[model samples]
Target: MKQLVILAGGKGTRLKDRLGDLPKPMIPIAGKPLLQHQIELAGAHGFGEVLLFVHHRADLIQEHFGQGSRFALPIRYITEKEPLGTAGAVLAGFDQLADRFVVMYGDTMMNVDLTRLWSAHEQSGADATLFLHPNNHPLDSDLVETNAEGWVTTFHNRPHAAGQFFRNLVNAGLYVIEKCALEPWSHDRKLMDFGKDLFPALLNRNAKLFGYNSPEFIKDIGTPDRYDWVCAQYEAGIVQRSSLATPQRVVFLDRDGTLVKEVSAQGLHRIEDLELLPGVSAAVHELNQTGLRAVMITNQPVVAKGFCTEEELQQIHNKLETLLGREHAFLDRIYYCPHHPEKGFPGERPELKIECKCRKPEPGMVLEAQRDLNIDLANSWFIGDTTTDVQTARNAGVKSILVRTGHGGADRKHDVAPDFVFESLPEAVQFIAARSTETSGE
Candidate 1:
């Protein structure tokens, strides 16, 4: 049986006033200590044994949960005479740490699937898998940049540059790490942190560090305002829906007019012609960070018209991916329609000229992606610049947003009527991020 390690050794300096004599983990939340909530959640997720690393007022915690027989969740403690930072505490418990174990901060009340997180860690074959989520305030929070495969490439702590926009993925203070990954620093016996010290060293060695971006609610009630908000969320039962109970949300985007500047009258036949519009990279990167899958659904009839071959189309996509990668952005998947109904062009290819279901206005690409990604259409949103795009969302039973960047101005009067209209892709993304906490039915 794997162990769940809870770091309950913090002094709670910021919360000292309200929680006078009590440790941060023992602070009451919804009529129970925060540690109790964490224990119950772990037990519910099949974690029968919990290893708590405690320092401040350790005796109080040990006496309260004695042997854990009452709750059926056995408890063990690793008392530290002096304060050990997050990672240091784990080293102290090195003898008992399992081959693979979970590490979570005791200050947070989060509703996540430990089972799924464990599964992700096992499948990734990574040294560590950090729990990442999009916080309301990205600019002021520590951000993480990841590739399309969810590998953590960079870590940007708070107090970033003076005026720089960044993706909103924040470390939620939960992790699944392998015991062998700590061998290098196990003998130090000094204060060390996962973020400030260990993670940076691992990144320098090109370690396999992945990020599990989850939409599940995870909040640290460190300040008074945040505490009140968490209490309100619990009272409203929003916490329950934020669990694995709800489906993941997706943002389906259009390629030409929406993501990049559309070509004049000619089709995109060369990679040099691909230019990402203003803020498109940042917007897509934000989607990547927000735990929302950013998928590209475009209609590329140039292949059937003989303007470009399928290989050339692939080259164009490669250019787009390279551009986005340069800005720390990536698309989860790209789906394009290469067929056209009317083929009278001089160099048209008959094999690729057949009418297909994947073209815009037909929900073929969206439906196929939904089937493959297990997406919930009702909770997803489609953003495009043409009337066909709006109609496609309607056909797929998902919400649609028409942007003014591409052909949006002329397509606004379409009969299908978009759910919302924005001036650009960034505006649409802003709207979606702001409403990320809203409840979804399907």
Candidate 2:
């Protein structure tokens, strides 16, 4: 079991009304302090020691969990003379840290399965593994980009450029880091943050950084609005159900002609050509409120035909994500198969022209999603615009919906019939939402 370090020094400027005499982490949630919940969660996951980095009103925090006996873990505290930034505080206490440790923020409310995150870090041999996820308000958030192998490629800090495109992956304020990775910067530390400063600086040195993408619920209660929202969600049992220990209900979606317009048969290879059909964003936003995971599973064979490069394909999907995000909607994950079984195009890449299992109508993509997301396929559903997607659902043993938008079963590539038919994605999503409500007896 590794040690856990919590940055419990937030002053709660925006939450002043809620924190009159108490520190931010000492604020009560369900009759107990928020920091206690975090420690209990860490202990449940086998963390034997806790290192609390405190500054604001350190007395209250010290008096509450002195020695961590009641919690069955040893609690250690390091009070800072001056406020250091998130990473600076950790670097300031460098000698007290373990060889490897987990970092968390005091303000954010999370129920992450830390064991799963730890296993990923140990297997990759990377200097650090960041917890990345897509959030609705990504324009103002710090973002990270990753390659297909889930390796961090670059960091996009806050105050993002006006029109530059970026993936919707946000740094969800949780991380796993190696002490040796910080040794290089231990002596020259000033005010620094993990996402904005330290992480980017390490990337320049060619240190391997991994991005662990997850869809679990983790929100920062920084503002009064956000604080109240999290309290309500916690009362509704949403927080408890979001842990990765439980299986999630997913609504798997097809990309072309389902969410984005089917601009051409070759697929919308160019970024400018990608556009959302009517009511797509709002429908997805509504599904988001239902707590069901929205995962994009699409077959993109344009790369095999050399009609578009993988870089161009990423931009097109970024456009899709940006459009949905503008309306307060986002997907949990986007999985695409770049292989095409058929060959002989004018500029086709012969390597990508081989038969593969990930192509749709095969269950490879869906099964892979099930394993990564812990999806309950028996209660899951898939919606698309072709009989090929219908056959994919049948092959994966999940309910299917066909929308009469692009191809609309007119391709007739397969003689499979969808379990349900609709004129558009909105209608199909409405049916699923209503069915879920009926099943849950809500």
Candidate 3:
């Protein structure tokens, strides 16, 4: 069994009102100590042993768990005489740690699949893997900028009030680290933090730092209000849903008019004709950071009309991904309908000329995606520039947003009312992200 380390030494002054002399890990949640929940989650995920780095109120933690026998896993403690920052405390117990071990903050209330995370780390062969997620409060959280491959390109801690807007993928205070990654700075005397100090150093050296972006519930109960919110989530079983097992919130997007500049009028058949609209890359990048699945749902009748072959259509999509990759934006998957109901063209394929359920204004694509992606329809949204897109969303039982960019605004004269209207993808993303915060009460 791999070893696990819990950094429980912080003073947790922000939570002093509820903690008193006890540490934040000792704070009771749903009739059990918070630390107990973490330990049990670890044990279930194949971490059979735990090492707790304690400083403030170490005796309370030790007395409560007592070698972890009652918890069904052996637990050990390492008391830090001085305040060693995040990385320093872990390095202090260097000898006991395995070549690869898991480290998580004691204050987090997250139920991640440790086995899956560890497997990802082992398969990637990276120096370290940080558990990253899209949080509602990216304004004050440490943000991570990654490429399409999920490799950390840059790490930024809490930026200044006037800093430029960034992606919402923040560090979730959980990681898998190799002992070799920290050996270089083990002898340093100064404070060593993971986000502010160690991670930046690793980036500067161009070390491989991968990020595992998960949608599992993970939050820091630093303040009193946040503590209440976490407890409520636990009671509602929100924290219990693992990313692999739970339904996801997705943003269904139309391809031509919504995501890129529509070229059907000019008959776009070549890869050179496919160009991403302004701010489209950043918009999709923000969606990626928010952990929302961006699935391209489009109606491509060009294939049925013989304007382009299926292979050519794929090349067009490949070009879209390649262009977005330059901006560090990526889409999870793409689904297109190659059939057209009416076909009077000279070279039209009769078989594909029939009306299909997967076409827009029908719900087949959304329904198929729902089955394949485990999408939560109520929490999902559809962004497009046509009445057909809005009708598709309505038929699929999800909210809809009509953009004014492509065929939206005056061009669309339909009785179907969208939930909201925005100028473009960027404006639509802002509305969705802000609405998520309001509903989450973050």
Candidate 4:
């Protein structure tokens, strides 16, 4: 029955170029808003009630998740007319919080076991416990040096301070704080941040502020590259997603190479060349029987290059559906990117070539499929034959299996590496199906 407060008020300046008008927390990752994933994780970790501190575009947050009942957790929102620093927002929302609670950053993603954190905090009897991680890039973080017993002895926020400390533990942006620690601040104070003001003040008073070292999967999506990295991790299955029931997983397929024989760039021009690879239909049928969705994510630059029309693409898909039906295998959804680089051809529109987020090597298409189809990126795997496909799965945070039939075998020698490699689509499918059964204890 722990209470949680999520600080989701930032303007997300770093993600503005990619996200446009959307708030940072609302940015989509694997089809759902980042904030939704955080909330769902909290619910899974046993947090019964949550308070979202929102400032910019608060309406969007409220609109998408009214009361949080759908996620099986009670939720409330606290809006601020003006930007409140981290500590200020917490102080303003103090009335809603209980005697003790956990505070987390909405823009960051982590698979932290909060139960362990709570237990550690209680055992130490500290006023606050800061979740800490080993600082791989200490130059760009607020570094902390802790004693053997985990009591933080020194804090440094600059690169020059690196050699001075004996350890490299940095704050992980998650904290468990007792209400009494925040009593010094007045709710109306205009500027106050935990790292800059509050924590220093606590140290000055010789308060018991401790660090809990748990180097779990933690990431801060503060910039476009980092946001992209987080998406890749989600696609790769490195990040665990919250789920009920048997924890359903998905299988993402590449249409061109693995599903059908390689159509020489010229031959792929018509529906006649589109054919399912050996055993592909039966493999998909087996996944369907097990309640797994077989989704197709592809990059069809042929449309952007003027080799085929959108109508022609639909016709090709129609032919695929007809073929799958003959073998009793159905595609749950098909996502394609029609954009090509601006220098694709003489007739290619520069606008189409302009860096689109949904292109392969980007997680946009797969993420859109996840959102529309409710596929779990963490538990799912993408099977493709090209390095671009591998990069796409890496960026989306899903595990990848390279099948030799398409560009997979060639991709094995490429710069990007996949988690698994198979000689053909059927081989990859058989491996994943067997692994799924083992995971299910069947």
Candidate 5:
């Protein structure tokens, strides 16, 4: 049986109106306490027991779910004498935690699949695996950067430096921690935090930290507006539907001229040349709010063409993510095909001059996305600015929306016609949203 540790010590001062005299975790969500929702989700995902760390109003929490028999899991409590920060409180109960335990904030509304997360933790063999996700407000949030292997490289806290474009990966306040990683700091009683203090220290010491990047639903309902919005999302079924445990309906987007301006056929090699089309941000934001996971599937042959390296291509995408973050939009993931079939180009990498299945007009990228994201292609759509995109969608057995943005169907390379055509991504999203509404009605 696995164990979960929840930090339920928040005083709820920000949510005073909703809390009354109850603790923050006791705030109502879907006619039950927020902690109840966490517990239920944990139980569904193979967490057989829970260990709650409490400080403020501990009695109320203990009184509601004593022994956890009703919740179908054994419950235990470790009451903290003072308001130690997130890491401090967890470290305070160092001896009580299992060898490897999952930690969740009691204030957040999350539907993560603990079984899947635990599996990832086991496979990676990391000292700590932090559950990270992209959010719309990365500008104001503490950011975490992971390398190509999904290992933690940097932690960028709030008050981000100006003009620096970072990936929109934010620490979503969920973790799978190995207790041995905390033994060295367990004796220090100072008020420490995870993102702000502890994580950076771990990285400084070359700790084996892994980041599990996901597109799942995890949001903190700390403030009144956030609480209201979370409650609305819960009632609308977005909270549960957004989890990775179930199949997701994705809106696969073409990068150039669809998400950003297309400079040339070879693709814009310089990061400065990147510019997003009008209404792109708002439309993507709508897809996010309406429960459609937006994924970008682009064909960038620049790496094979010698125009730019893969590193440069990543920075360009990072800039795109930063721009979208400013407008409160995020992509679930970005998949691109960098291999070019044609050979004998000057300064080209001979190794990459081979035909790859992931190229556009082939079903490789979409198929890979289908597997990685558990996407339901029959109910999904591919919005692009060219005929090849429509052809790709047709090949993948998904509905296609051709936008008149970049090529606007000018290229006759592919004879396939899209199921629908729109002036831009915004209009296409609107039509798709309406169609979703109609389908839900049935």
Candidate 6:
């Protein structure tokens, strides 16, 4: 059986503020964490045995997935007390790895066909196979120049060299390695990355390191904005959510105005005022029964405005859940931006207003939600009552629907028009259900 090793030890320092208290791999995309998706993908690719290398938050990972049997694959964990570079982590798990194994970065997500990658490696008869993808911004990444036969000729770490080779290809952070490749790395060496160190050493020894080029979706969620983008792609169906046993889709809704009446501009000070629009609960229930996750993305500037505290917002959301529960409907997840643009208000500050990608119209919330939830945006849809919501979907490259309830009806007269418009939430549900039926040939 093919063995898979995932490097899951990164602290994700770049995303510390946004994903506090969680390891980089545990950061959520839509509703599920990134690590969950990686595991699911391994299972999907038919890997019977898998290994996870953990250092930071090792307990969190172990607690959540003890054996990985639930995912139909056997998983083992190796914890490191000190920092181990990419190659080191793989070497650390050397005993567990099979003669032929696949190694990948845990914090990054990709839709690569492992079967094809493995086939290529076997056909080339190479000691190692490196996955490569076209790079538009080579300067930001380590550039790899390859020969006509797909053998990597030179590896440049952030080189300023200007040429066709620079724009040709870059490492996609996925690799298949034979057990012999690890023999050369000195056991005493520390702080080594595969691209910068191991691959170069292999090249000097004239080892067979072949490159496999395929059409695969790859993204590095090293920063908050990238995290958001990956999530949105999943929601829009641009990329498949790796968590589900079978293909699953979701419709992300903007809460404040799309499902319920817009919180009064003066503010929703009371729980009783939280009211759902006509047919809103029923529409959401329909989606839930159909195996779709109905997530809420709202911008509650109230906390930043000092109209209420974060606690107040949580209480209001609690009230919303109670109200919806009465109708047998539930929200899978709720994401809101509490920061505001100006600091005139006592609790608010100009820094909060400084341009942020997560705010509505920026696609940050939708993207992050997609990463956590694994929603497919191209196959999924976003329904809201405001232009910002529509713009958010557009910026994130997802389909947008506008419901007549709340601010939606008013938005029709604005400059941008939604892909579809409905007089009420039920109408939108009916339309989507019919479309789904048509798609499934039922």
Best by lDDT: 5
Error of 3 at 148 (Å): 1.6
Which candidate comes out best when scored by TM-score?
5
lDDT by residue (tens digit), candidate 6, 287-400: 754546677888777777777766667767755654565476766667788776665666564545555777787888988876655567788788887877787778887888
In model 5, which regions exceed 4 Å deviation? none
Work out the TM-score per prediction. Answer: 0.70, 0.96, 0.66, 0.55, 0.98, 0.55
Rank the models by lDDT, top first.
Answer: 5, 2, 3, 1, 4, 6
lDDT of 2 at 205: 91
Return the TM-score for candidate 5, rounded to 2 decimals. 0.98
Better of 1 and 2 by TM-score: 2
lDDT of 5 by residue, 295-395 (tens): 99988889999999999999998899999999999998989888999987789998888878999999999999887778889999999989999999999
lDDT, residue 187, candidate 1: 73
Candidates' C-alpha lDDT:
0.82, 0.90, 0.82, 0.77, 0.91, 0.75
Error of 5 at 41 (Å): 1.0
Cα lDDT for residue 421, model 4?
87
Model 1: weakest 10-residue lDDT segment is 433-442
Candidate 1, clashing residue pairs?
A: none
Clashes of each: 0, 0, 0, 14, 0, 29
> lDDT of model 4 at residue 322?
51
C-alpha lDDT of residue 257 in model 6: 69
* For every candidate, C-alpha RMSD to the true structure in Å: 6.9, 1.5, 8.9, 19.5, 1.2, 17.6
Tens-digit lDDT track for model 4 on 236-265?
554553221223477989888888888785
Model 3: per-residue Cα lDDT at residue 115: 80
* TM-score of candidate 3 to 2 decimals: 0.66
